[model samples]
Target: MTFQVARMNEQESAAWLGLVTVCQLLPAALDSQLKQDSGMTHFEFSVLSVLRFAPDHTLRMTALAETTSSTLPRLSHVCSRLEKRGLTDRFPCPEDGRATNVRLTPEGRNALVRAMPGHIDTARRLVVDALTPEQLDALAQVTAVIRGQLDDGRPARGNPFA
Candidate 1:
């Protein structure tokens, strides 16, 4: 069989590389800030924050995983850790016995509240403050377009920008 490989043009390559670089570096930076300030990883902070805003401070495991862009297994593991720390609780959903539900404890809410200031500051230092308002808007638009393309028509829940 014969095949041809398509290569990106210089402009496409530059854009792709820039995106890759940001994806690689941003997570570590956010994790570092969260770990130092709150004794939690960035993903853990996200889970708590999402739960804090959820109705009744609870969400189904599947819904939480979708909102956080995490796999169910990974979210389950994180939830387990949070449960052990007394920050969250997971139990079988009453309305749907087949589904699991997770809730942020009051302590989890407090922890998230404490984490937010430092997290926001770090975000501003690393990203928000680095962009002009116009650039920020463009970035949001660009990411939204990409997210729509990748999300398989699944509506996003509780997206702050949305």
Candidate 2:
């Protein structure tokens, strides 16, 4: 027997649209909230959080940019802003004079301490509270699938090549 192809109905269309909406909207919402509540943009928050986990709360600028998925120029601009706020320190790397290192200053740590609670609350409100346990598990699995495909030289399941 041959399979009959059918077009997606309105409900299917709505679900597809909703998934896109959540993906796009949630980050913007979180960024706005973080900026309003903590004076930190989400990108800036990511940089700070990454540095927080590094040894002595420092990382080479190139490494920091990579970890944050940012370009050096963009990271440098953010670093400059953070520096103005006295939240970070930038110095030439002692081990490699040609490289630069960024470190979280005491004030930066304090800012992160204050901002984290609000950021967590916002994340919960926008994401965690909205997902069921089953959905969360599914999402994790789906994300892994996508990442695996990216790493394994395979197209994702939906792609014709895969």
lDDT winner = 1
Candidate 2 versus the native: TM-score? 0.80
Per-residue CA lDDT of model 2 for 1-162, tens digit only, reads 999899889998997798788879977987898899999998888888888888899999998886776799999999999999999999999999999999999999899889888888887777778999998898779767756865576443221100
Tens digits of lDDT, candidate 1, 50-138? 88888999999999998988999999999999999999999999999999999999999899889889999998999999999999999
Stretches of candidate 2 above 4 Å error?
A: 1-19, 149-162
Every candidate's lDDT: 0.90, 0.84
Pairs clashing within candidate 2: none
- Give per-model TM-scores: 0.94, 0.80
